[model samples]
Target: MRISTSQFYETSSANYQRNFSNVVKTGQQASDNIRVRTAADDPVGAARLLQLQQQSNLIDQYDGNITNVRNSLGTSESTLNGITNILARVKELTISAGSGGYTDADRKADAQELTQLEEQLYSLMNSRDENGKYLFSGSRGDTPPYVRNADGTYTYQGDQSTLSLQVGDMLTMASNESGYSVFEQALNTSRSQTKLTSPLVDDGRVSLSNGQVSGSTQYNDRFRGGEPYTITFTSSTQFKITDAANNDVTLEATGEGKFDPSKPGGVTFRGVEMALDINLSDADKPNADALIAGHTFSLGSKPDEVSGSRSPGNTSSSQITGASISDSTAYNNAFPGGGAVIKFTSASAYEVYAQPMGPDARPVATGTLTGTPATKAKIAGVDFDFSAPPAAGDQFSVKVDNHQTQNILDTISEFRKALELPVDKDLASRQKYQGALQSAIGNLESGANKVAEAISSIGARGAALDVQADTNESLKMANTKTQSSIRDADPAEVLTRLSLQQTMLQASQLAFTKISSLSLFNRL
Candidate 1:
């Protein structure tokens, strides 16, 4: 191992430099705490930390999203609560107005109050979020969900779409309820009385059912879709049905439960399920004491469909005339129905009335229509043969009043109007509303229940958001801990290694100084 002085010095210098570099690197690691500041320190650990960092950022974003969801859902819940409270108050007012002792003046005062309440309801339905977006407007957040029509009635202008937000990796939640579901699609219905009565008497009663649009095989369409119809008793033993407008519907035997006069207690008129219980009455046949001779007749003999056209001379054919039949009423007995229509009984008058049985009838709802309805007015799901004019609250349509629900709003609104019945109109008008108020109450309750359910759904979503937030937070903490384990260096271990490197560097320098001195001067 003989070496020149220059070679010895160069080798010693290289050794010293190597030990000094180790000392610097280890000292830096001890000072910094982390094992890998860059890929050069620990390539695999740095790559893994990068992935974890990205995950942690995503978790933070999800948490932010959860916060927004809570805010939006909380707003929805609060708004729905307000609406429910309003409905409750309306229910209270309706009950108070139904009192028999309430005078006309008193009822008028109630109506004024109700008008204010209706306006309040309108405002509540058109609620907006803090950001000025319509809450119930669904995906169309910028547009107003409800609009007051010219008739003073409200209409839903928003589409039926929900707004959803991503709250977690696999979780998404709906943040808004569509106006249709919250306001327009409430679970209310106008069902025909569970039991119906079909009388053979002139003033006899008959119940009508809301016919299906499908015109199902069980019960087919018997009358026109948009036309008003009448079933009149020509005698104590016979009755016939006539269409007041275009004949778009007809009776067919194809359905399972079509009008079968021959069947016992199973009779229908124009697809309307009729309850027939033939009964004999003392008046059926007057004794000889009262008339020339004793005449006895059966109470019910299902009369065949009257086939004929409108003519002054013919009575067998179905006839629709301006002639008002006995006991004509504004209330249609057959129900369980859609469509909200107002009909003018008199030719183009502002006065509106309901004619379920005949032409002459007392108006059930008395208010101002913005004008005449664009189409025929519907009451209890059947068209009212709309006549133009007379100002009232307004003639409006509720498609939610579809066949399943009938025109429940018409029934309820009419019941409300009846609260302020006029003395001049038929006293029977109040009687009709008085009888129907109970059923209308049931419908209102149903609507309220639907709103409650929707509110509950929103609350549930809020709860889910909380759960996702907690889950993301836990996941984020775990990711941080794992990243720490992979990238963080032990302080004691780093310190020890740094000290050893410094010692090595010091020893290398002293050895190099001694060896270089011997090779040049001491060697001589």
Candidate 2:
């Protein structure tokens, strides 16, 4: 092939320039210690490296999530520990109170200490996390979980929602406990003196103008002919009376010495009903009377006759003849059995009978009694009546339900007040309360243990995640190395190739210079 001298020189000069550029670029790349600076240099290596970098970033994110979960669990654990400690102290106080040697003053001091402990428990229940969120409030982390009432009751303000965190793929852990279960359920089932006894009359009777017993009086007859009458209830609620025909008669206050049958009354069976004729002139000591009215017996079917005389002057002048029965007959008719038996179906429930007495007259025989076909006794403003016979040697159980921890503490305080027996008797009573308190403490401890175990489980999972993250990071690094080997330029090899290119460029430049100098002569 015939080639021109000018063309040969031009091609050689271009080759020289290309070789020189290659030498410089390769040398610079080798100095930088990276084989591929851009995608264009090594497309496959660049894509693989980017994938590895993304994996590394994901590992970092996983690590951060694990950190957050650990922090949350730690805070929760601390708060739960505090609650456990308080419960332990309460258990100790309960044991001390049950020793039977402490005086009322001692009990009062213990109660005060318990009150403070309850307050501490309240504070613990409302503990916040590092992020200013309530730990025990469950998913409602923003609000306080426990609310204290004026009557020393506690109300659970938080919902039963649990907060969950994802620690791994398809693995989640609960980060919080429900305040409702921990506080509300705990408070409801864990104390003594939980129940109060209110006076109730079954088969109640009133005077009638007619011969047969009739409810045609101005005052409403709550009971039917055959159904038992419920005169009072011990709860903070009103009594419900179901007639033989299943009718409800509601009663409320009307005026002085009167009751409205359709309204709600404020008198609870266990609660004292005090009527105060408040004189604005005397602020220190107000005139107070027992708001509760005595049971009145009469001879007519009219309830208004209940407020009238018990018997007429003469049998001929009487509306109902032979209505004036003896107190023994009345007591027998009301109780059926002689009024000395007490029946109990459970610890807090019992039934007994109250002997007939004149208005405002205390019963001659008023003491604790228990047997079949229950008896009634008046003690400490409570009329304990037993419906069924209790187990041999069984006593009436008192249970108190309160809203707040402090309210439960106050209920204990009331129990201490109600127990006015000798030290041994009081000790026995205190033991009953102590047993209940111990049960409550056990429940709390069990809950706390469960929470702690759960937290530990979460911590283990978090630790596992940390290991996984580390492994993933290592995998990413190895993957990056593989990608570099496959497509990235090796520094040493690149530098050597660059040096060869530079040498080739130098030789091409010298040859081109000689060619340019003798083009015409060489062509000839």
Highest lDDT: give the candidate number: 1
RMSD after Cα superposition, model 2:
24.3
Candidate 1 ranges beyond 4 A from true positions = 1-18, 191-425, 435-439
**203-236, model 2: which lDDT tens digit per residue?**
1111101111111221223222423323332111
Q: What TM-score, over all chains together, does every model reach?
A: 0.62, 0.51
How many steric overlaps does candidate 1 have?
Answer: 19
Kindly give the stretch of ten consecutive residues in candidate 2 with the minimal lDDT sum. Answer: 302-311
Number of the top TM-score candidate: 1
The residue-level lDDT of candidate 2 at 431 comes to 41
What would the per-residue lDDT of candidate 1 be over residues 115-162, giving only the tens digit for each residue?
666667677778899899999887888888765543334445576789
| Residue 214 of model 2, lDDT score | 15
| Prediction 2 TM-score vs. true | 0.51
